[model samples]
Target: MVAVGYTLMCEQAGPKQLVDYAVRAEDAGFGLAVVSDHYYPWLESQGHSPYAWSLLGAVAQATSRIDLMTMVTCPTRRYHPAVVAQKAATMGLLSDGRFTLGLGSGENLNEHVVGAWPHVQERHEMLEEALQIIRPLLDGETLTYSGDHFEVPEAYLWDRPERPVPIALAASGPSSVDLAGEYADALINTEPDPHVIDLFDSAGGAGKPRYGQVAICYGPDEEQCRKIAHEQFRWFGLGWKVNADLPGPESFDSASSFVREEDVADSIPCGPDLEAHVAAFKRFVDAGFTHVAVVQVGDETQPRFLDWARDEFLPRLRQL
Candidate 1:
């Protein structure tokens, strides 16, 4: 069976609401849950960005059965890898081995705020070095490294879990995929592309789990859902190259000024139609993704969407 997880969009909800929804998700039958780790929301209209680690601690305490993970966190900048390692270890212990650390080479919006904006290749190299620093530290070894991007002087996680927390690396292109294959316990991608799966498999990741995320908006009214999706998630269609380089919400606003509601309606499944939502998920399953994270856009429809998923969507999805 494909593992279906719910996305706790920190950008769109506050800490209490996120914990409430995660507890609801466990009660509603989602086997796993993932939260976005962002310092800022993609757009100002979406409006909230709580410290994800704190909220995750609350979710871990509130829910017992569901697995939890960050959809993606960048350890190269803003945070040193050693800090991430210590945090991930503590989260793993808090969640009783149910936590997975999802990582990626970050976007300019988050990483650039630290005052150093590296190019894509440099970012990838930084991520590789971060992984090297993280893996050994999580394994409870004292590590010292002087790499091109970062340096650690006799660093080790004192409060680490007995086992290393699994790492899932996000990949948007060939280089990232290659890195995932070489260093990660799993692979994550936003798109349903078989070529990516093939590339990962051929590059030493054949048996590793692949996770994919799909954005959708479900409401009683199709038009309203389309509007909400367009308003909040239209930045997703900008392509990774553009999405990774853009500095802030205003830059995204300027870039996506021409994006239409119909364009969002075309890409994301909107409305209460069960088949449309199922088809969106099936694309990822068909592309060989073992785990799928469904991001339901908009805060107002969250309760309804979770109810619908538990009662309608999940049963059909399991059958698929």
Candidate 2:
């Protein structure tokens, strides 16, 4: 059967506060936690970006039996795969081996900070290279790698967990999905596009786990939430240049062509009645996403969602 999880903002909620919520979610029967990994706050208004790996450690200590995953982490840039491998190994050991490393091609918005910019095509190659480099190192031995994108000399992981950690790549495109099926343990495609399932299976991911996530605002009113979700969260749907990594001079053109300032405004579903919130999730379920994540995006009514998730959402979802 398919499963359910949530995407959390560590910077917004703080590690302990977020972990405390996940503990309650686990108790209430949620299956996993997909924490965001960001170096800088995506929006100036949101105002936070705690180091994700440290937060994952707290999450591991807080919940037993519930999977703790980065909704996705970008290893090709800001951090080297070798270091990510080391940290993931430690997190796995700390969590008693319940961790799954989520990978992605990454956004220019985040990865470019490290000075290596990636075009979509290059990012595809980077993801492949990153996985190749990181997986072997996670084997708990001294490793050596020299690739087109990265190099490591006799770099070995110390304190790795006894078992090999699973790797899941978050991807939506055909080539990237195929790469995951060919190399990774699972898939996380956050957009509620069920057609992505066919794309994945076409690439040999038929039996592998697939995950999706969506944003929602829950309250008595629907229009109010849409306004909040759209304006505050609009940064997400902006075009390739602004999001995908592109080389110098070209990225500005790509970002400018496909995305406009209004599109960057928040427009995700928020502050709606329990019925509408369930309806929003149903789209993912109908689209064939086996694991769906509901991310709480704003600060104004985030707490009321605890009551909404427990009293309103979970109980109602069980019947469906």
Each model's lDDT? 0.92, 0.74
Candidate 1 lDDT over 1-320, as tens digits, reads 99999999999999999999999899889999999998888888889899999999999999899999998999988899999999999999999999999999888887888887898778888999999999888888999999998989789788867878999999967888898999899999999999999999987899899999999898889999999998898898999889888899888888888999999899999998989999999999999999999999998789999998889989999998
Where does the lowest 10-residue lDDT sum fall in candidate 2?
246-255
Off by more than 4 A, model 2 = 139-142, 239-241, 245-267
Clashes of 2: 16
- In order, how many clashes per candidate? 0, 16
Residue 168, model 2, lDDT = 86
Model 2 lDDT vs. the true structure? Answer: 0.74
CA-RMSD of model 1 = 0.9
